[model samples]
Target: MKKSYSIEEINSYLNGELIGTTTHLIEGPEQLQAAKSHHISFIGSIKYAKYWAASKACAAIVNDNLTMEPIDNKAIIKVKNADLAMAKVLELFNPPAPEFTIDIHPTAVIHDTAIIGKGCKIGANCYVGKDVELGDNVILYPNVCVFDETVIGENTVVWSGTVIRERCIIGSHCIFHTNVSIGADGFGYRPSEDGRGLVKIPQIGNVIIGHYVEIGANSCVDRAKFSSTIIGDGCKIDNLVQIAHNSVMGRFCIMAGHSGLAGSVTLGDGVIIGGSASIKDHTTIHSGATVGAGSGVVGDVEAGKTVLGYPAQDARDMLKQWVAMRQFMKKQ
Candidate 1:
């Protein structure tokens, strides 16, 4: 059930300045445009201030720097940053997580040589292969599969229908969502000399995932042909993303939904790959680089640069090209 709070209570919780009436009760938060008289909203910047005049919200959490003034009937809680304050508000209204018992289910199959740790929960029909090591507090949801010789560190949660192939190394506090595939065979093949179709290259390496990584549902990380395919600490990969064989991602990199890195691609720390972006094989994206949505990067990207469009170039250069083409078309 949603809780209702007085304007004074919310202002105190946010440690923000209160304007106008304090007796109004706020049921919950909603977007400014869609908010009702009982719902509270936020105005984070001057650009959004225009919406306030048309909004029906009885109260709003607004940024202190925004030129929003006190109105006759409504309340305003002015904070240092509206977006961050909204996050705190959301946490206040967050729901409880699903509960799982700290015991292995009867249908789970564990090999004799597998080492299960303290407080681990293995769900129904899950398979833990021989010599697999699960550290303390690991949770494997129903129907998950772990192949032989895999080592999953403490407090990692693997959701339903996920699979971890043999010899993979997973670090602590990682969350692999449903249907995530780790250490799958790389797409490597060569034409045979004897008129046969092709020969598959053996994928002998594993995947090494660092701590605090969260891989979304349906994402796949392929095993390397030689060494390990590495995902560094704090990396966040969105749903349906693909990390090809031999790819290396540095700490805290973000890959949006449907983004993909071809084999042998290297991404430095803090690189942001937008949705549907694709990096070519052997491409190196330096630290702090941003690949715009739907971009196709075919070459190396310099540090701190933002690239856009197919065969990605600097964002400013791409914008200039578009402007020039528009002018040329107008003359014709």
Candidate 2:
């Protein structure tokens, strides 16, 4: 069932400056063009301001700087940032959390030496290897596998089909989405003595993931050949990302979908990697660096630089080259 809130109620929730009357009810949030008399809309930027006058919404969330002509049937709630205010409003209308009863399912196979923490929910077909320690409120969804000696902190949630390999350390409030594989073998090999084939170099190190980190579905973080592969606090890794062995990412790094880092790559704090970008081995990307989508990074990137293209040069330089190429093609 959809919940309805009055204009005054929403204003109180978002601490917004209420404009016009507050008698109408808001069923939910919608875009300006799609909103109806019972729905609320938002205008985050001036680009969408033109639609405000024609919107049929009962109320609209707008930034404090926005100025629109008053409409009789509509109310305006002004906030510091319309986008942030919209996030709060969306939470209010979000569905209730799913309930999980029977903390440990009967079908779960847990080793006798494993320590299950308080308020944990281990679902059906899940496997907890020997000597594993799961902290309080940890929830493992169905078919999840936690290998031997792995330690997971409080309130961490591992979704179905995910695997945490041996001796990994995952911090509190971390989320591992479906099919994520942590601490897999690194792609390391040695030339064989006979020179016929390559010899597999054993991956002896594990992964260390910090608090509030969320790894998206189907991503893989390889175990290091030595020492740990570390993912820093609050990092958000998108789906299908590959974090190679011995790689260390500083706090709050954002890696978009299909982006990857080769072995021993280092990323400083707040680095942003766009979709499908790849950084070569032993490279360092400094803090606040922005790597554009589909870029191929082969060397170290300086702090606060925005790089683009195959060789990943300065974004402005790459744009100029592209423009020159286009002009030359036109001449032909």
Each candidate structure's TM-score, on Cα atoms with residue i matched to residue i, is 0.92, 0.94
What range of 10 consecutive residues in model 1 has the weakest lDDT sum? 93-102
lDDT at position 74, candidate 1 = 85
Q: Write candidate 2's Cα lDDT for 1-332 as tens digits.
A: 87999999999999989988646788899999998899999998888989988888888999999886558978899999999999999998999755566789899999999998999999989999999999999999899999999999999999999999999999999999999999999999999999999999999999999999999999999999999999999999999999999999999999999999999999999999999999999999999999999999999999999999999999999999999999999999
- In model 1, the runs with Cα more than 4 Å from the true position are 1-4, 21-27
- Put down candidate 1 lDDT per residue, 142-181, tens digits, no spaces: 9999999999999999999999999999999999999999
**Model 1 / residue 19 / CA error / Å:** 3.2
